[model samples]
Target: MRFNKSIISISYMLLFFQISISILGTNNYIVSIPYLKYYFDIIVLFATISCILSFFSQTIAVKELVFIVLWLVVSAITLVTTKDILVVTNALMIISARKFSIKKTVQTVFFANLFSLTTTLILFILGFVSDNNNGTVNKHSFGLSHPNQLGAVLMVLILCSAYLFIHASKNIKFILVILNIFYLLLLNSSGSRGAILASLLMFFVLILFYTKPNYLYSICLLIGVFFFCFSLYSTSTSVYASGSILNKLDTVLTNRVRMNNVFMTNYGIKIFGQQVLYTGGSSIMYHADYAYLDNGYLRNLINFGISYSLLFYIYLISVIRKVNSLNLYSAYIIIIPMLVYGFVEEGFTSFLTNIVLLFTSILFISNEKERE
Candidate 1:
């Protein structure tokens, strides 16, 4: 495939803009820009249409056509039901970049996030951004909307850097140490146990992958399946019941299990997504009530509907199989952590935060020999 410099540059800029806007939107100190979301929606719509045109311009096979049609149907349903354009936009961006290498896609997302995170932290240190701790001394938002947001952003950056470093023939040990140390600091400062645990698990899995590659697949699969099932169980069960194990677990997870149960019981699951009014901890100042379902599995089922959530899980599992078949250990290692993180956070639902979703383009392409 011949490289088109103009197309590549345009796609890169579009991805950077999309990711930057998404990250900046999470910062608490930034004054809400009037009509900014509308502008974003416009750009995303234009970009998706342009990408679809570019994608169809090439000679596509029957298999590709079938997949594309199915994806479009799901995307349309998701957009109409959930009103989430970003999910569709992320997939379209990946489709648009099919002609390019996956490495380029990862690099684009990594740098964009790094830039946003650095800027936010700088402003925070300069006292230009307000640090919201939810009236607690132990937890810090670090300029983002919540303490967990900082941890989530850092986790994304760490995974991206780890993948890049592993593929670039760098000192993996040193990179792992540095990344884990940074994660520990963030954990201590922000009290984001979910992100810290996810990072630690990723680190351990990577080490095992290097030392015992033969058993790594089964281990990862088991961990992912366990988390997925646990998330479902917690969401379905009545976590507030006295003497229930889920109730104890809910306390350990800072009430995430109970919140999931509340939302699931109230809204229930649907085949197509529904509009959910999520009043998170950050909204406490504005509203008397607060409920946030941090579990990604439940969030997807409730927000995007049962069908969309199932499709996403199927896609994720297929990606894992492809990674194993292609011996893409680095990608597999990174994906496992994202899956585990989803058990406690909703970041897995968005491509801007979850790089694994972007890999769908590479894994689904006709040529299976392409290396990242």
Candidate 2:
């Protein structure tokens, strides 16, 4: 598997920017450097151009083009209805996924995330990033907008780290293990219950699939559904209001669940997605102006509506199936957790989600050739 240097370089650069832009576009930084957020748009543009160049160099699958068109339609709808151009970033990543094999893309993302996490840790140690205290808990934001965001990032890193650990060289394995531990600690510190559980479940499922492939695959699938529901319930405040095991774990989730209900009640299920007229709601803490739908699936419904979002989900699952066919269990380790955590996290709507999607898509197509 000869590596394309240009693709690797651009992919890593794009990923670094995708992960770091949240911190870079922080309120303080935005105030300090007006319009700094727009710089991320330039990064997206560069990534898109790189993908276009790769298209001529590499043979593209019909399936890749189909997904790309679907993503662009999504971006177009988002632009038309919400006037949000950020969807282009997501669209570009879908296209960019064709540039590398699954292994290369996974390794690159693993390293990029490691770099981002390490940078966050250094900044926290240097007092550049605040260690936030939220009444009941002391959480590390690591320069992101919120502790949950940090947890979300750590969740992806944990899965990637686990994959790397399984495949790393003897010398590299120890470091990967150490990084995994660090990621777990940060995830716990961030108090993202959904991500924590999702990561654990992903690792467990992967282990079962690897070790007991014949007996456990069906059982693991059943357990995955149960675990996913339990995780969602654990993260939702309304599900266990009686100060039960759920509340004992975390009360903030009650607020999040309530906010989710509010959106569902207010917006209802629309075939063509409705504009979110109001962003203010009970679950919002830092951003009092906008309502926070903590669930990514629900958020997708709001942004792209039922019909289009369902199309997106179908495309995503097809890619996941492709990865599974290639036996790239690590990509599953990264994506499955993200999908579960997306129930309670908002990464699906952002560039970070698309980055994962990009890699998974590329892995799907690239690995197909290996089979051939």
Candidate 3:
């Protein structure tokens, strides 16, 4: 796969900005940078326009064109209703990368995240950035705004590393093992049960990919679908009723079920989207009360609307199917765990944090080729 050099550079720039902003944006210190918010907006705007112009220079298949038009229209509506530009920007970034090599794109994202995480850690170690304890002695945020944020970033990095190790290096299994051990230690230190479980699940999937290749695709699909449905069901039940089982599950999820219930009760689901102020974790320092919806499925439904949430899920299923057909097990392996993690973490919604979201372009591009 070949791309114009200028297009490739622009895409890398966009990826770097998105990854850096998403990772560092969670840092209490980075957020304090003067005009940082405006800088992000300007970068996004520039990238969006550059991506659109680049698309015009390429020959898009009819089916691909239709998909892009429909997606952009929906994203525009989501932007207007949700007041979140990340959705539209994410869509554009994926569209822009349709012609680029998936391996190159994944490598770019992996290195970008690696750099961002390293820089943040160094700052934290130097005492330039303060770690958030959230009034807990056992949990540490590692210079992030919250402990979960640290775990979530590590989870993303691990997923990326796993993909690269599997697809890009045949001799790195030992290194991968060491990395997983290190990740487990960090996750334990942060007390992020969700990330810990998700990372373990990812490791299990990777082992299954080698030990039970035939069952890999089906199992992954089932896990993703089951968790997504479970997320919806748990959130709904938490809002209306409670039971011993529900209480135990809520306790295990650190009261996320109850918090989601609070958000759902206050602001019902919307078809378009609505603005909801989230406060909890480090946010409690400013707000008197604590409230936050950590479930990605519910968060998208409440913040981006049912339409966007449904379409996003449908798109994910489609990508899984397409990648399975293409024998892209690396992508499949990375995506499924992220899907499961979404049940407990909201970062799964962002393309920057969840690189699997960018794999949507592969589905469209492959479809176009098949048509040809």
Candidate 4:
């Protein structure tokens, strides 16, 4: 028997973001290979391989049909790596914890994190794996950029998995708080300013400034946003949009300004995948000042085109719209995090972790059955 169409469509769209990176990683940045490409390049490669291995072994989850549709689109435009497809395929399996047992839910989230986090930590350890007389800058193995981002991602997953486990298995808020403190610190320390800021933004906008906020909350939120944006305006844009912005405020508004300029100028919008038209630089100099907006909407418009950007936003916002008025905290867990973290890290743009999120979300959200 066929499954629900809504689930299929949502899942497929979620997968579309990953399809872009198959051509080249580094977010289209000019990657200078130290030895191999960077560790993240390898991570994506591994994700694709792992995903493909799962498929051949018949361990592939039966994804929503829309996933097939999205896959076709991916195959048509970009080289849909086996690894990338496999990552989405993992989400296709309708995961549930033995008839809604919280224990199962906690374990599922935790075990999943264990696999990803262990891999990430290994990458971290491997950074110092080599013996080099000169400080040649291991740019790839472990650096300020890739591994740190991966580590931050794993850290967030660790906290979230712990949250799910604590509540599901034993209902311990204290443990959740302590772990969350560590998560926040790791998020900030990982140098992923986006992840750190996004988490705070999620907590602020979704939790504090959500609706009719009390006066104190409103004042506090405004102050926070003002100070945050102020700081981002002061530093650098590349880091904020590419990484995280909260702790550093590092350079978000500049990125947004550039994007806003692009949108203001019609030439910035690309219908098909054309880098020249959007990035506003000569082909030769493209790599010199090549930068994408830290803002999510801007990045889409710049890379994939404005139309794709709109579609992506619509799809993401749908999660909120669908969950609206449902009063589901589980749903809030994902929604809040995406909104917060998305500002900097491109959480939605990331592959393996995002699949875990989208799959887990649909499990509890009401929208899965809406168009069934």
- Could you give candidate 4's per-residue lDDT for residues 251-307 as a string of tens digits? 433243443333324334455323323342433432324343445434444445444
- Model 3 compared with the native: what TM-score? 0.88
Q: Candidate 2 lDDT, tens digit per residue, 1-372? A: 234556556665666666566444542221255677576676666667766755654566777677677777777776677555656666676667666555656666666666666776676677666655443566756665567667777777777777666767998888877877877887888877777878787677678657864543344344435644554354344544666665444355545555555566566656656577555343353333346676776776765577666766665666665555666555556666666676667676565643456664444454544422
Residue-level lDDT tens digits of model 3 in 1-372 = 235556666766777777777667657684378755575586577558656755754677897787678768888899997788877876776667665566666777877766776888899998878888778899998887788888887787787778777865556767766866877787788887777777777878888777876676798788887887777677555433456566778877767777766677678889878888886545542232557778888888888888778778887888788777877777766787888888888888877677777775567654433311
TM-score comparison, 2 vs 4, better candidate: 2
In candidate 3, where is summed lDDT lowest over 10 consecutive residues?
280-289
> Which prediction has more favorable TM-score, 2 or 3?
3
Q: Estimate each model's TM-score.
A: 0.88, 0.80, 0.88, 0.52
Instruction: List, in order, the clash count of every candidate structure.
Output: 0, 4, 0, 13
Instruction: Give the CA lDDT, 0 to 100, for residue 252 in model 2.
Output: 58
The residue pairs in collision within model 3 are none
Best by lDDT: 3
**Scored by CA lDDT, what does every candidate get?**
0.73, 0.62, 0.74, 0.39
* lDDT for predicted candidate 3 compared with the true structure: 0.74
Model 2: how far is 211 from its true place, Å? 1.4
In model 3, the runs with Cα more than 4 Å from the true position are 1-5, 30-32, 46-50, 170-177, 237-243, 281-288, 366-372
**Model 1, residue pairs in steric clash:** none
**Which residue runs of candidate 2 sit more than 4 Å off their true CA positions?**
1-8, 27-31, 214-252, 277-290, 351-355, 360-372
Please, what are the lDDT tens digits per residue for candidate 1 over residues 1-372? 334545555666777777787767657765666765565675586558547555634566676667666666887788898888755775575456554456776778878877887898898898767787867899997887788887887787777776777766457657655765765686568777777777777778778777886676787788779988888788756686877999988778877787777787778888988888788545543232458778888888888887777778777787777777767777766788888888888887877677777676555554445533
